[model samples]
Target: MTDVQTDTTLCDPQDMAGRLHTALSDLVRDCKARMLRPRPGHQPTADLSGFRLGITWLAQQRQMDSMLDLAEQLVREAPALVGGHGRKPETLDQLRACMVPVLRALPEVNRPPAQRLEWLFGTLLVDELQCLPHAEVMAVLERNAFQPRHWQYIVPYLEQNLPKVKGTGLSWQGQERRRRLLGYAWQACQKAGWADRAEALFRRELSVCACYGELAELLVHRGDVEEAQTVLLKGIAKYNASRPELTMGWLDRLESLNGVG
Candidate 1:
């Protein structure tokens, strides 16, 4: 019941690679020129037309070395281009818009895997943090799988930012972002073997959001089955009228935990 389309024409990989390199080289040149000399009253722009498609095509062709070479050029040049204007929000926003394709491609291109972590924590999260929003920065983290060695960097950044996000004004959307950030903080603490900090963060999140199902899951994870059951029962009662689907899901989880399913 499915239809498929196939291409039968043959294309030269070398020609494709040459064109991709030429495009990236042009981008790097344009970025450097703009950074070195800025025009008054005009925002600098880099045309990223076909950039992502080029990178994706090269990656699909399994030309990793070529992709890495292009990525490193962008990584080295981007900070200078983005930060050349000294963090003026408008200028930074303009620069970030130009660099998004490069940023999104870097994680896929860096070799040895750990190199990606280094670029992410040491460069993007630290130096380029000013140009990026927390959500965009977190997107990079969400995309990549990191190891225990990353805990040293990840935990500190999460700890530092959690309070700042918490201190934002009382808006529903802001509070929602805070809850999501708190979840990351809690997970980072737990992964770093800081069980007490993790537990405290979980409780703090519960107090803020009153997402009792999550609290119950945490308690169940720590072997507090009776407490978890109590929490889930409370969740089911609270949401049963307003959020029947969520209540049913929590009921299923509770029953499974109690060996009732």
Candidate 2:
């Protein structure tokens, strides 16, 4: 449950990785024992609670390949117990969540770049990759951004989903979610040294209304409060009539930036 800072120098990667690996191994062993002792004519249910606990442990470990083999094994064995795809079992989801951060931090190891990339984006795992949480996706992109193929894959995947946010017919919740996704993706791209690409994406796809709200927040975090205010003001003017509540929120942000309202 402790938050491990992403900095490798602050912690011992080997010790942390080994501890998590052993913990996950024990969990799988226990789950296997439970699966074998099912009631007569009834398949035993797989307990997923330990998987989440493993994921929490995995998240604290700095990104490293020391645990990749363990992750691959878990992924291979997960489907038999927790069927994925449309029926994304919680165990499989938790497994993917744990494995992604490790994969993202794999750049420190001197593995075969192409082979590791293939393993990270494996065919059997691509579907599950789409189901990764927003934070995990951003972490993966940020960690692998230096790799041309990784950057190439993430940018297009996000761009392809941009069109769905173009129209104004979306419900407020739908629009808000889209805005957050795009905004976080932009932040990820920027963190990967793709600020130009992020800006281009904002201009080409998200330069309006709620998306501007996202942009403003990004700027605010970047300490460009004035620019954030400008973006929100523009959004306020544009969305005031049809999206009054959203605009009001934007205006509130704008005024807060100026120490007013």
Candidate 3:
């Protein structure tokens, strides 16, 4: 039997919206202040803190307009804030470091139905996700696990924006991002008890080193050495010339397994 709980008192939506706006207003103010007097290094201590506070409140409120407004503003200003055009790369890097968290806080499943997911904004989000330090990516992924529907938006965004790998020239950063994205997406599926979904996602593309590594490792751990060997071989053959180091590592690991080294 399902137990049901009912709300005894309802909070006014308008009041919640007001509070959301106020919180976001403070975040925006802090962003500008921090931007004016930039901090040392690419560490975004203050700006990230402010964005976290506002985003936490925004999530609680579930106010789509407020969330979109903040997201749009941040996305629009990012290139400039990052000092696009002949500006110092260091400054842009620092700015990006500061903005990554704020951008990650943008609501995915809670986004308004009316809001069109722009490719440019999606591209920005992917870039931010890729550029974020590994530790931060894991943290974001941990949060994403609780929001299963977020993958509905995030996966499509990635499919559209994540460039396919080609030729012997590989963008290491892009590959790393793809690997992390796949890891998170697969983890999200697995956590939801969607084993088939996880397999499909992990096998969808060999765009990154870990895509093959993780899948192969899982298979090997599950006593499917032949399948694991095949997965690893395919990965090595496909990526050897372009990413010899990573593929070679996978090869070494595959060789250590019994049969079909």
Candidate 4:
């Protein structure tokens, strides 16, 4: 009888680690080469979904160290991979995919808070509005506590993206996502004791989307009762025909403001 050879390499942790590293390195090289030498009118694409799958596999294998290593490498390479001149919509989508996993994993990874914050602000949040969608990025922020330094990025991001929410030819779904993100941004600003910024954001959103109910609530919170009443009236008039439910809700609030109910 011929002796049977069992393949032990697949089960060896050390070998698996080496293989993972090699695979990731090769992926990075391929992505970088594509970025460096782009075909005309062809946007370079990163296999972000595949990359996320690999990260998930690493997590399933309980390879925490390898996951962190991959996160670090991704953060370091992110700007180069998706940034610079002639960025197309496709590139932003790729950036969003690449950063989503990194943002989710960084909090759990054993890293210094300062270093993580540096990565968050310096690398990820730099021109974040361009690279990330309001909803996905805000979901990550909602999960984490707001740091004071976060205001610097958060303010500018809100300012830039809120206007795009309305009259930008977005679908209803797109508008809804931006509206949800706006709500989260308002709450975050309030939590961070940036009431002024929160009010500003509400006003900015109102200018773009006529978010009267939201802005009126904020105004009432800040003791601007008269303005709140005016806003509610405007909302009642604007939405009464098309959005009866919303108008009814605003009417209730207005009645309360007037001590009528």
Ranking 1 against 4 by lDDT, winner: 4
lDDT of 2 by residue, 12-58 (tens): 65665655556556656655665565344534444544434444344
Kindly list the per-residue Cα lDDT of model 1 for residues 100-131, writing each as its tens digit.
55456666664654566455444432322233
Off by over 4 Å in 3: 1-125, 128-134, 140-172, 207-210, 221-223, 256-261
* Per-residue lDDT over 7-49 for candidate 4, one digit per residue giving the tens place of the 0 to 100 score: 3235554455455556556655766676687667745444455
Specify the poorest-scoring 10-residue window by lDDT in model 3: 1-10
lDDT tens digits, residues 10-90, model 3?
645455445544554554565566656666665432233333344345555665455445544544454343432223555
**RMSD (Å) per prediction:** 11.9, 10.8, 10.6, 9.8
Best by TM-score: 3
- Stretches of candidate 1 exceeding 4 Å from the true structure: 1-51, 54-149, 163-183, 259-261
Error of model 4, residue 227, in angstroms = 2.2
Between prediction 3 and prediction 4, which has the larger TM-score? 3
Question: Model 1, 128: alpha-carbon shift in Å?
Answer: 19
Error of 4 at 79 (Å): 25
Residue 157 lDDT in candidate 3: 48
Candidate 1 lands at a TM-score of 0.43
lDDT of each: 0.56, 0.55, 0.52, 0.59
Q: Quick one: ranking by TM-score, best first? A: 3, 4, 2, 1
